[model samples]
Target: MSRRSVSTRGVKWPIVSAVGLHGGMDVLELRAEADAILAELVGAPGGSARLREDQWQAVAALVEERRRALVVQRTGWGKSAVYFVATALLRRRGSGPTVIVSPLLALMRNQVEAAARAGIRAHTINSANPEEWESIHEEVERGETDVLLVSPERLNAVDFREQVLPKLAATTGLLVVDEAHCISDWGHDFRPDYRRLRAMLAELPAGVPVLATTATANARVTADVAEQLGTGGGEALVLRGPLDRESLRLGVVRLPDAAHRLGWLAEHLDDLQGSGIVYALTVAAAEEATAFLRQRGFRVASYTGRTENADRLQAEADLQQNRVKALIATSALGMGFDKPDLGFVVHLGSPSSPIAYYQQVGRAGRGVEHADVLLLPGKEDEAIWRYFADTAFPPEARVRETLSALAGAGRPLSVPALEAVVDLRRTRLETMLKVLDVDGAVKRVKGGWISTGEQWVYDSERYAWVARQRAAEQQAMRDYVSTTQCRMEFLRRQLDDEGAVPCGRCDNCAGPWVDSDVSAETLTGAVKELDRPGVEIEPRRMWPTGMPALGIDLKGRISAKEQCSTGRALGRLSDIGWGNRLRPLLAENAPDGPVPDDVLQAAVAVLADWARSPGGWAPDVPDASARPVGVVAVPSVTRPQLVGSLAEGIAAVGRLPFLGTLTYGGPGGAHAARRSNSAQRLRGLFGAFTVSEELAGALARSPGPVLLVDDYTDSGWTLAVAARLLRQAGAQQVLPLVLAAAG
Candidate 1:
């Protein structure tokens, strides 16, 4: 309760070395006081808490010098400790609550608990707790809260930004940006919401110390983030330490294919020290890996963006409490998930970049003395990486189109309305708009987005540079899996870490510490699990809103009468099993050929299984229509022979008649609708499909459902519209069957 809690003259803080021993008496006193406060923050008594030199340097910069600092240290370096100690010291000096712009809910939960241990009253306003927002805001307003954590996305929220942010900026004792690298576009996980931090930084009063910390930033990202932190015109203190984890024993076991990778995990996952994460490249892969692991009797759960918030929370808790062996996860579980004693991190496929891989693996070997880090690189890694690469900064033409649309609208248009005019998908479109908003080209208002009349030029050169850098990083990951150099050094060099050197512990440095062999029995089981095809294709239940504005007749929900029944696909194109085969067969430039015998046989197997499934076919459900009476193909602009042959083969196999194909007459035909958002796609295929007279007569005469066949399904809207046509032509039901699903 001393008035001079933080040393104004940088004096009286407890010293751990001779340098502090030589300081003035006041310096000694200040050091002592700091040591005591650190003890209290760490839930220890009698100055038991100690700070590392780098940690002390950051704390001193913020408390003693009242300066902004960007600490780009590795994870488990006590970045949170520096901020919590600073907040306590500043609060004792009569400063207000520290406002932390955190990036993830998991991180927030951890911070809140950590703060409570230090007797700091911390609360968060995120998507999880709407009911508590009012009470939390009241507490913040009444100065009852010591630390306030808000997600980056909350910065642009209409109410929060307008009402609460300005006040917090004016009076906050400290401004902390956790996971700060997210603010830089050059960073691997750049988020548009993080860009809003620039606005927050601009609004902070002079002399309010700011701290931004991130564990995975490369040198370029570090410099960019430091530059952004200089919003008040003063240079930021950059406390960057060497990126190395002594406890991590890194190794790469290059597996031949998906089955081997899964088999390796099943065989060796339990042997690796403790509970950890099993990273997958895609949601489909994560689910598949989770199922396969469970079948092998490993307790696990799948975590992905598609998982509900409640389920994600439960999964994180499960891992923290060691109730599950691991969380088979996609990138959604990547950043900000903290567990000090996580014992292992195994990747089913190599991440595209060394930096990203380092970030994911850093979660382990944190508190434990020794942890296993393994990379089981797969053949499909590069393709998945390219799929993500395509979503980066849109082309110049697309940018111009967006600006033009906003400028011409004379009013704000929500994302859906914008999609009607722009061809970009919803995610990419929203990302572009956020970037534009941050660049002052547009502004988010009450209704939607509006042009700010700012002349914007697309930075083609910068984006191209980023693209090249991505390609180079991908190559570096490829090298990491195949190289003989120290795995740690290879990753460190990718981050431009000055201390990059051989760790003498990786497989290359230690003669393969991890076993790469998988038992034949395990491999066979894995192959069966993967090769066992058939994924349920859930039909689109509702039409996208605002279709009328785009000159499409569809709106609101599609009555169950016109909707296609829940269908089935052999597999997802992103899956590890049939995905490999389907990728080549469904490639953009793949030849127009008849369905391969293996794939045709697989399709027939799917149908046979579907018929026996409960609630499937005529008598399975009392109210449901009977089994498919005929087969009809949807003409494919790119693969007519494939669709035609598949339909004929299905009819020939099931002993059903082969109805004629649906004619395609729209501009560019079926090929033009290859990639589009729901609204745009609906517009593209609204009138493109029509049932021929012969098919109409066949459907009218048919007493049972028709097996609607297609080469592939992307949006499922094509099947929906086609089903409507068939049902209108008197078909009982339209059971959609496709070769692959576009997840």
Candidate 2:
């Protein structure tokens, strides 16, 4: 279809009017009206704030023709603007409020604010605002809201899907899917929640125009997303643009190790152009980097999935206002965070894929003329990638097992209940359930999941291809870090950008613009900071819900008297310092041995510091009974020597009795419980450990708290169980102390 530009009311709007029309308004008149609405939405007057040709085409397809469209453009290419403009134009036509399936809270917040600026009222119903959902739903029903933003995860919520979604789908004027690439398993970030959109799309009224947008989709992902958008045989218009950002000056700084990389950031972070992001591979790494940077006098905050919602919002605000030099973060802070003047992005470790890397770096240089994008690849990166790689879709056997369990249950089974029957972890089981739900193999009801009894064939080949893709992407990331070619060109090529060319701004095209040299003093300080270990071990206060259904005798909150007190660990297994020192000692093949002298010394120091701190076990109690009277070791099948030595060493250092080891009753008990869910772990260890007469006498003699030591703590159930036994055996208190915590 061709368009004719038309002028209207002192404003120049692109109007495409057709002769011998298709029973619709003149294309030109529709375009003029859309243009006027776009101008007003962007807070510009007259001819200003005009929509780009591609943007206008997508908008026209959605509004004028009432068609489905997918727009794959780079970050900051105004994808949100296209949807907002369409919402305004469609609302003026007396259509119902636009329903936008946004991917993140940050994105929703940004969209709501941007829509308000454009004079389009919008509200969000997400996990963060459960209290506001009822009122928001009322507003939507009242026809008072212009746009309603709901997270994809909300699409599967029983009440929302059954109650609000049908109404919204039947009456929605326009449907928008932000970060639409997530719909495809082939996409860099495949969210099963997004897959539920297929059902949502199929449920929508035939004429309800749909819009899907993303910045990181490649050829495969683009096709997949476009296909998903084509529900009910509606052809979706795919509008893709070049994926190059000339403003990003890309470079890779190869550091020798985690310390060097951390030290380099600590030394040169301020020298970077402006405040930006420091991405880490894990939550522990983020916290470590944030702590080290703060010690180095740079105001910074840690942002990760673990960060509280309020803290995350504040961290975003801090970065936006330039209060903090950076926010050391995980992938949680990457997508949908809009900061126009973001000046730099530095990775502490390489992500698994170049596409993921490119997407993250896209956060920078969005509005500025130039922004720095540096990758400080670490030796530990590949291991971290491998750790995350386990999240891949499980084998067919496991999928079949889950389906069979649900089918046999005859009723809805919660994820925890499924976990009791399936060997998968909680996260993996939940993800599998979601994928199954999307595939129609299962349904999520109010109670939990019930098998739909659908014949679900596992796409083994597709999963294999995805696994291979992950490996290839990991190798590509390696290539990107070591490539002599232009970094920007390399990233663009990975995204299938045809216009991939050296931008003469990267270190390969030009020369390194950042300083990699770190002073000895700074390096030493970084090492010291990382080596200073002592992370609080917050005990599990409440038992998991629905445990009785899993054949476990546990429910509701664990009584305070029966709980293990908040304790300490030498360090997180993910820590930059002790993590390196502890990994080998705790490896699967690692021989059972005594605690190394250095590690033992460090553990002693941590204990000393913990005992003297203001928040110590008996801070200011002056009860003389504050100190731990004895040290009890949890028996370790794999590391008995290590556990025994650690307890003995602590007792000797603190001049306390060394309570004998807790006895293991079976050949394969807690040792076999690794990687299992809580219910399985609890069952495996219920009476596996016995309080020996010797240890019982030691505990009885020491009515005060006794230090319960273990080689490592994973589920914390082991410690909890041991602590409960010790308490039941007449110990006044149980203080858990572990060498490492698997976070």
Candidate 3:
């Protein structure tokens, strides 16, 4: 192989070129042409800008030799530039428009703008812009579009896959996979949808160039992706660079608890260099942090999966323009967010994988001289990691169950319809279906998914290996937190960077640069904010789709007469304050006992606040109903003691009579129905609860309102079903209260 070297910031890096010239263009001529294009793409003064040697090598491999390549570099190393430059060069040679499979809407937006600066006309087709899809497709068909960007999910869409993908694959000048590490199941953020790219790759016309790029693939992930990229081509030329970011100053800030961690952020957020991101492990934590920060007079916004699309776009714009001090976010904002001068990144809890942490922190310090990256590791991080781990590829038996259900349906079954038969959660079931779709076990069409009747063997070995890999990565993250070695070097080494060395910038290399001390007042405020517990448990107003498929007549919205009032919970299990306290107690192995005194007190306080708050049962409210005349417990087979105690305590506190518990009239027992989808959960509880004669008499005596108590509420189906029974029996109004809520 012939190699070229470019000097950047006084360091020489080698670029490998494994192919000869094409289209009467020699290596030297191609290099000159690529340099000219780079200058135009970057809008350099008088076309003075030039391509780095490695970038030129990758470009040359694609344009001059029509070869596939993978580029693994740091966040700001110009991976997008490679594809844009190649697209320009390939188009000039009379090739077809480039097709780029991008991951995030933010990334696609940035790419479109960047391509314009280079004089390349770009268009995108994602879920966000459905109305423009027809026009965009026409533009591509007319050969007026320079590049067309589509999300991975778009590749498998029935219309796109059948109508658009074939034409695009046949005519595309270049194929680019941005954030390519997602294709590897071994990668920290593997997405099953990316696996569909293999079919597209295989369908490409011979000699079409391809480029895959990412910033956070270790050796294992790199190898996996490279192998996939070579599906049609002989081999992919991989150009991996050093992972060090000279502008990043990494450190760990150890705090006593969630309160201290949040308090430190409140006290020192402005002291950080500039506007940046504050990452939380869960959506609830992010929302909580955002609320507390705003209450403290800081301009911050929350961005999570639950955030509306318009709000997400607005939040991204706010951060880009420095309107907000920080965007408290979950992993939803992790990849493809482009901010050149993001001054700092503060993680409320360590991610399960060091590679994922590196990818997130890489968002900062990309274009600045120095940026701070701090990790405030929480003790609850491991528990969260385990919770997420449980959602991985379902057990072999579950997979078979899904396949059998599809096979027996005799026609297409929508995900919601499948949910009634399959016990998996909606998201998990959809993910499994996508994976099965790729494996040819199922096919998605106009109505929904249908069985292909393909013999699908469960790859238990691969799944087990992946699970082990996840465990190892989690352990590596724990080590990274406690390691005495250089923090940056540790991260680099985890990514298999052979050049990893002490950067002398991290807290481990030098002394900590961030202040850990939080003011007493700030700490008190944080504690108070966290201690105030009460999350509205929105009642399930509508039945789940495809309920009739399960032999149940329920459909559409549940009638208001049978519906429970919007209820309340002491706190969410994902909450930073109460979650830490409640997780262990509600854990599968935790001993079931009466609610603790502290929890009981918290529940009482929650009730007090609920009474006086707006739309509450306070007498001052115009249409306020009388307070609960009695309390009734929802029978809990797993924690009967806890439910009984909570109901009795609340009734005693309110000086209301304690109604007897609802009898368990089971088709399927209460505990047996746990963790299933809404339809399945409702089916299990349809007639599972019955108002006993004693409870019915108590409700008849009062007939005003009743407090329905349960140990926990996740799907809200239990409360909904139980409330319906009570309403049908006698109670005028039912208000549900629970110890903890699950997101």
Candidate 4:
């Protein structure tokens, strides 16, 4: 296990001396050795591959000087090469495995494979591979693993942090923070878990050679990350290069609407050269685009947060191997996907941050001569941006409530248990907890979270500043879409790239290369697809965890008899189809009125389609009792007219009785039911809807299936609780029908 014994491809690395020189080798000789290793790492033909000057400087700083460094280079700038070459050199001197904190699973997988190409043994311990943790840890302990990749969230796992992190920190040769922008609150993709690295950086035995690398950080983000990297008391070496992708030809395609944008894609996707990615702003949009493109005889698939991991892997492989034309993806497929020949990138809607947009489009044209990058900005882009921005750091009051609850618990409280006491949804709650954990306000223990009892002051000023920064970024994106200047230069300037200049390749600089004209046939088909309605609303089968703690006495599987049957919604609020039409009507500030005639017609069509579907209530089907004999409306605190009118209209169309609306008997009126977490929402909704005596009598008289109508279904708890009440009141079955599903 001596340092000299670690050989790759019959090349003997120089031994390290106590003075940190490679066996008395001078700088030039060491540089020669690094070049030789880089040749093997990149498979450079004839061993002629060499690192860029900056890449070489980074390697030398880490290996020879043992200094922390921050590298901000563009996507295809051989940043990975700097680390793998540094790992090879560092291990030659008998340093423990290099620990990499990568952000995404796609990035980790790509890094592992890339490491193998350079004769470095790399392993990952992510949520996706829990069963291999023990073996991976053993490999690291035995020095059989050269590189260990882990997600940033893994840094704070109670067991991993307490048991594994200390050992890794002590023996680590080099620490790499990939996608380093995430560590900065100023960055577009700020992640709280990344802040835990500050503690590890402080604990690192001096001169452990820390490196933080990113392709997306602007000047502000760079300064923040560099400052964090220097937490151990030595200034980090900052190496930033031009943030331009020479292989990219940028353009903006301004279409009239979602249908035209989709139509344009269908018309021109085949001509975009090799396989690529079609980026959508939401899961629904990605799925919608994927379905339309496939129906148009194009090979496509959807990749989003909701896609199964197995399917994501398959989709990645398909796109990599050109098995499919493209993967209709959200930001899930954004970073570190190692398709060097990706031919194009198309955004169905512009992202709110130009920096994020740059990071995504950088995935293309890595190894190729040129790749097309088009921004098809949508009118609804700003609305989608606002929806995502709603999950920013919670208010001071909410944070204090969470801390108070944890303090009063006297024991560790799991997130689900905390949901009963706190109002934040699961994801936002977890995010807040991570931030609090970093701030010394709370601690995650074996079971769940516990109050650290540390006097924590809410940083309201910092949070407000971050919020304003987000707003400014959104406006910048608006400017990007409308700017007549070079699109690439605009992005580069946003990143504060000093080397940014007009590329003379974008649509504004040169005449548009992409044909914006959508064929009449394609336009008609896309419009028809978007116009189609009725998405299945899968009913919740199990109550929220720890519901009994809310005094509802509900837990485990909801009884089959009490559960509402599968329901239907005209569309999802995040979808590209009916969502556009329904969003305005369902907006909080929208005027309360009867359902519009067009929307009513769409709802009626949804019901008809539901009745005719297999396992539906069509008379041609075998089951006579399946058909709803009457319609019951969930009393809408905000939109009673909309809900009642829709119910009456559906009942009239179907020749069924219109049962009266359920009574809103719960506390706090509509505000209480608007809680974010499922547990709290259920608690608010448990007694909210009561079947009135008139509705009870109507249900009892019908004694068959009933259509439970509502204006919207967000948590589905409103529908579930209302259905439970209706079922208890003598309705034989409850079927939920709604205008829109919340994304």
Candidate 5:
């Protein structure tokens, strides 16, 4: 936003008409507080400041909740508007000043500049000389500044923490965390620093609330975010839902080259109204797309992670105001920004995941107008995509390095100092630490580090990449991309099986592309035990009810915690409705929440199986307590014959969780091999067993002494569909299995 002669940018709404709390609290009161803040700014500050409806609600939530809240909003969800709005409201009520932990220098200054334009008093203390920083500190301490926005590192400074934090914490009505997903390692971008946010908030009194805002969070990403915030297990009231955009039109086009797509875009400029965004997979692509599109007769702008924030912001504004008809950019183009009315999001390459694609596409249609997402799917893009995934997860070494630096410092180091040891050059690391601060790993004060960011011991980027790639591969393995049938029918039916109704808003339903039906036999109906390969799973030692239990405590083996709490697992999954493709479906559907107890049970089972397996692995316990559980060995199969036979006994219970099947194949893989050998010795007593996908996959593909192996839960739809397909394949005796379950 900029101020110029006759511009509305700098103009503020009057007290009588300004925005207010969701309860419709008086805006006049907010204006008065802002006015008071202005009056105390060494002089009458200037114009007026107000917030939009969503901003007002965010402020009220932070002030009243007395706990951290994660706000999953849409693009154009104002980052600064909420804080200033809260400040304005509280100032009117005589509440303390607000402290905003911002991500960038330009963000702070841009906000300051906007406030300056609005005639409000605001400035940055960071990057200033000692004397200047002190001056700003005094202003904040004196409650002269209504809203003091500083980077997490700046706030972590010992000097800032000592003098300003406590004072600010007590009176500060709300602490706002913008782009909140930056806190989680699972996000599109990961920052180790974001892990320390919780301790920072604790510095304040019991009542000061924290506000977390983000544009998007996929299922797993959503969980990771909450975990970082100390509220993952259903403690905080989370507001999560896709920001429904009507004006955005999403389309997928399989294009061969950037030049071709850019040229096509130029030809469609009339439809775009000279206002649109073109997303590239990389900075190089952004630049090329920009140049090529520019030469094609459109004034194109571009930005990447390498672009300076100031210039990027200008490009954003230029694009928004129509100074530029279009912009070519990498994923870095739109964070903490609101350009609501752009007409299109043309992706030069397909995003690694649909969620990323969704978030980027969501940028358009902010005004709820027509917009489009043009994706060019290419396998070649995988390398670049992997680069992002690889980069998103910082190496464990860098994280450990950050921890070592923090441990060495007796007091909070300034932001610049903390980043010195970090190898990554991205400015987001510090900001990410701030995000992680919401999680318990890092500690913080308003001014700065009570503790530096926490260590994510897991190679999250690698793990995360594996999960994404795994999901992608799972889909490919099922071969839906090659399906010639009504894609919508197939996809929607899969979601329905997974409990997701047809959105009807997506391209498959309304787009020009149409698919004719193929044979019903061809579809992956619902994954069934018959389709899956199985394996052997025996208790490491029999339970107390059996010989396995007798062997464990009496002699050689593990502890209780490491042991599978079958009782706990049973209790947790009780509400999971007996499985059949749980993760992604639950992420989108579940009456209680995304992760049902059954799914939790599945997680626990993984540990139990690991315990039973020779490896002494406990799926849930990442640590040593994960010892062997029991030993009552039963061989399973990588193939379905044994599992299919078992399915005949169970009468098809709600579709096998992983592969829904009426009947699965018989003994195959190592499962049968082991059983064959054991059976010969034991005679008829040892035969191949069966399992549900939930049990099979959770227990490393061996379920209830049997195992299954088909590992993709993309939207959870394919699993259900595949299970159905297996059932149709009709080998019978089907069991279930999955290695890792993710949304």
Candidate 6:
């Protein structure tokens, strides 16, 4: 049977081909035709307002529901266009007006400009005066306003209650609440005013249909919406899914401090020329960092809540257009914004929480290729967060303030206006808001403002809870800093919400742990050594009194392994399978001087296990020593035969030299990095001579030196592994040329 092939053309190709590669003429014509309408809505709406496949389905759902159906979306995916298109569908119906509750003035203006450009009659209500608002009201009354957007600050006014909601309620219109996740405290953005949204909808007599959308909301937020809006269980059509995008290469880089980290960023940034974002903890730092980077010739922009709307727009536009190579921002850049083709996202410090970090890092790599998200390690990030929490955040006082603010407004007020009236600085207010947001005290709306819910005094309320949680996480971070596990694996575990093991995507998984363990063990003996009665304990441990045994726990001491009284006793007990039988056996059968055969066998097994395990860690044990076992010297990679051989060895394991974010030592591990991710590919490329005498001809000696030279070393794991394998294979001496002994 013959099968038919698909034809390249399927429709009115001329009309359908609106855009294609390289700025095709058809796309330019379509944009020209769309310019007028889009320009008007430019400032009126700010979101990922582009058309998408699922949005088409939503447009169909809204029509099917008769009233607009609610749309709940995750972040980094455009949710704004779902409503824009639904309203466009409304225009075709010519029956109802569409009203949007936006909390950002810049966003409202942006959407308005876009609509005006698109030839759509878009208008905004004025928060400054009733008179100006009446004009917009009149247009809505005439049914000429296809889309009427209002900041919640404007909508919460008594004047608006008496005029606008009544008219909008009576008219056949669609009510869209963008950034709907603000309704719950579980979200990063929360607004108390958004809680009263259902009640306000009830105030509208014609039953204005409600539609909500957000970039992210876990299951609780989704469930809360149904409960809050009386949509009933499953009444709201849920289309939630994983926020993952395959194109994104999510990773974080941690350092001991900010100074060196920033230096590291500057070093690698030469090739990363497209737009990117750097998130800092404070507004000042954001500005300072941007200026510093800019002085260094990086085309950078900075944004915080303090940045003027005009400046913010220009900065965002500059980033989107690649005019600015990078933007130093805070949480201000997280939601309802899109700047495609970003090459990197540099976190000036570690994120306050995994959620914030995940969201911020998720921003990069949205383009066709891989991108980076780096988190500089240290206390600066944590200290700034704590200062405000400890200083101005009296939880109860904040709760009272929020409750009072909510009560005074009577109607819901936008977050910005509330922030304006609050007595504290922006950071304090934000902390209060995050608390209120979590406790369902307020809700968030698109454009970064928040809304309050019901009246409630906050006495050590949200602040206390958030602060406590932050503190616990901070302790975990401290523990991580002091830990001996591979740094990359620890980072991976810290970021995993489900407590999964290291992802192998990190440096630890990539093999850094090998060098750390081996080097550390070499300093401490591999066997336990009993001290003479008055010999004194190891200095690494604090000189605690009691003149106890070496195995006893002592404060201020660090060793190959921590030995607490209880743990030592438990270990001793476990060794004999039980206390009674083991005590007698150890007393009667102490090996007469020479080491026992079983102990020797155990050490061999442990060594074998360490060789095979990922990041294997072993404490110094008693008594087995080696005679500088067969050494295998690795030559410099510049030697074609050596480079080919090394390449051959790495490729044998199906790995490859990954050029981005990973390398093996030599001037930043240049040669080793060259063979990183593509190890497998190179192995195939050198199939004939993989580890052949052609590469090891010099290792023909009885204890040869296998010195592999490279420019730099992050950790000496790669060379160590090669050295170990060659030594095991009977090459005399195995020493890494780059593994310099302790300074």
Q: Of 2 and 5, which scores higher on lDDT? A: 2
Lowest summed lDDT across 10 adjacent residues in model 1 is found at 1-10
Segments of candidate 2 deviating more than 4 angstroms? 1-32, 546-552, 618-625
Candidate-wise lDDT, in order: 0.85, 0.83, 0.87, 0.87, 0.47, 0.47
**TM-score versus the correct structure, for each prediction:** 0.95, 0.93, 0.94, 0.95, 0.51, 0.51
lDDT per residue for candidate 4 within 348-426, as digits (tens), equals 9998999899999998888788899999999888778867777789998899999999999899999999898888988
Against the true structure, candidate 5 reaches a TM-score of 0.51
> What's the residue-level lDDT of 327 in candidate 6?
83
Q: How far is candidate 6 from the true structure (C-alpha RMSD, Å)?
A: 24.9
Which has the greatest TM-score? 1
When summed lDDT is taken over every stretch of 10 residues in candidate 4, the lowest stretch is 1-10
Task: Please give the RMSD to the true structure for each candidate, in Å.
Answer: 4.1, 3.8, 3.1, 4.9, 20.3, 24.9
Error of 4 at 586 (Å): 0.8
Once model 6 is optimally superposed onto the true structure by TM-score, how far is the C-alpha of residue 339 displaced, in angstroms? 2.1
lDDT of 3 by residue, 125-241 (tens): 998999999999999999999999999889889999999999999999999998999999989888888999999899999999999999999999999999999998789989999
Stronger candidate by lDDT (2 vs 4): 4
Off by over 4 Å in 3: 1-33, 43-47, 617-624, 667-669
Q: Candidate 5 lDDT, tens digit per residue, 518-589?
A: 222222221111112112222222211112222322223423322222111111110111222332332222
- lDDT tens per residue, model 2, 1-743: 55655332222335333334333557667766766776776566575456656677788788878899999899877788788888998898888999999878898887788788778999999999999999999999999999999998899999998999899988999999998878999987898998888877898887889999988888999889988988773878888888888788998888777788888998788788879999998899898888888877889999998999999999999998999888999999868898888999999889999998988998997777889999998777776676667688987898999888888988898887776777777988888889989999999999999988888889989989988888899999999988998888888898888888888999999998876788899888888888887888878777765567666788878876677777788887776678777877888889988899888888888888888877577442334337888889898878888989999999998899887888889666456777777776776787788998888887777788889998788888899888888888987778888889886
Over all chains combined, what TM-score does candidate 6 have?
Answer: 0.51
In model 2, the clashing pairs are: 15-28, 16-27, 16-28, 17-28
Model 4: residues >4 Å from true position, as ranges? 1-25, 617-625, 667-672
Question: Residue 207 in candidate 6 has what lDDT?
Answer: 36
Q: For model 4, what is the C-alpha lDDT against the true structure? A: 0.87
